[model samples]
Target: MSFNNGGYLETDDALRMLDLLSQASGSDFYMSLESKGKKVAGEIQTLFSDNMEVLEIGGYSYVAEVASAPGSGKGVARGLPLAVVRDCDAATASIASLLYSQDSDLIVNILVFKAGGDNADRQPFFEIELTGGRVSQHAILTGGMPKRPCEIIVFSYRAVEIKSAPQLVSGIRGAVRSAKLVNN
Candidate 1:
């Protein structure tokens, strides 16, 4: 469906659309794109059916798990977290907050992608950050296409058993890619 004359989908309409997508996908795709926290994490875990603890901080959610130590017999704790904010501005702020809350020695690497505009062919704006020690990664992407008004942020704590950050990002991309409109 096209946006209203305002060139944007109304909040209610967006929420309704999210609900429909969530129901159809049986994943928290809607919540992952709407809210930012445990709700999103819970929805994501549903897709993989991997049991993990959900943790929330500063409007972001994470999947906490234990991973095997590289070449070791022990296990290490990690987190797979995500945040879905409204826009790029919010995403930036969220990133800043996340940095402040973490250790000062943390090193963050951010990469952004924005080529197309608002057209259907436009690629969603995307940013990915790998935190220090490769312990965690944070990613943010514009909802794009049918849900152009929102941004999705995802986090992946590198764990041996858990999916990598890029892999988790691909899952979110898959959810958005599968969205379709049907005429009644």
Candidate 2:
């Protein structure tokens, strides 16, 4: 159940662990982190224009970019949409590409911060859980997440959904297809 001499789980090992955990089929959930700060908005736009593989999760779309320096706790991010897409429940949708750190180890969590209310640390709109350790913890849910935009000012995110994994890849694929327009 290890990849290298470090004994860290590799693809094969990870799968084996999942098989044992009975959570093989992961969930495809996401966090919509919202922000109106000029600095945050500008950064998201710049990052999106730079990336080629735009990760379209459901009605949401995002691109991952790296933070300029180390220990910044900041990184590439997403911006609010100019218009609403069908099936996109929330009005203000922003995904945050955050650089996380645990025990001096760096990690990343791309979340979707929704809009509404006035609290900044309110509950989430969705929960995205990953069996593999990416965004801390095993399950993330939206039970306690508040329905406000200001509640998500910063602090990146942490999924609360109780699922194996958020199937965002497939969801992104669907989003891309839905984005396709007809030449009238």
Candidate 3:
């Protein structure tokens, strides 16, 4: 659908469009995209290029512009554990705050990826990656009332372009979440 006459998307319309896109492409596609903390510019042009309806949407240009901007996907280090939280809610809030913060780092997004190898027996290990935060130093993940140090493990990094989105979702997520921690 096209934007309103003002050339802007309303919240409801935007949400609806996202719902349609997610439904059409499947949650697994979005989950994979979200997991890797990557933007959908590539997919829009490649995966959905054949769909005339999707191509007609005017918002794709903005997505591509944002993705190609300097320091767009370059600033935030992937898979850097900032701190430990009491629960998942706290973690979500922390990530949101960082994304909304006005720091020079301009954090665009935050993502969590599995750090454990293909071992179901291992605990559900994961790490955080910041998309556009200017982290100058490495920080440890500490939390709780008394506060204790959490062990840091080797994380995965996406060294090459993933050719198959469906086949390499898990591998991509794992790799995208493997960057060393950095702090401002």
TM-score for candidate 2, residues paired by index = 0.18
The numbered model that scores best in lDDT is 1
lDDT of 1 by residue, 33-130 (tens): 11222221221222222332221112222334467858988765554443333333433554435544543223222211122222222222232233
Per-residue CA lDDT of model 2 for 49-118, tens digit only, reads 1131212232222222343467777754422111111112222232223213321121222333233322
By lDDT, the candidates rank as 1, 3, 2
Q: What tens-digit string does per-residue lDDT give for candidate 3 at 54-156?
A: 1111111111011234757654432332221111222333333333443333222221223323322221123223334332211224343223332111112
After best superposition, candidate 3 residue 69: deviation in angstroms?
17
For model 3, the local distance difference test gives 0.26
Error of 1 at 3 (Å): 30
Off by over 4 Å in 1: 1-61, 85-144, 154-184
- Candidate whose TM-score is highest: 3
Error of 3 at 45 (Å): 32
lDDT of 1 at 77: 56
The 10 consecutive residues of candidate 3 with the worst lDDT sum are 55-64
Q: What are the models' TM-scores?
A: 0.24, 0.18, 0.25
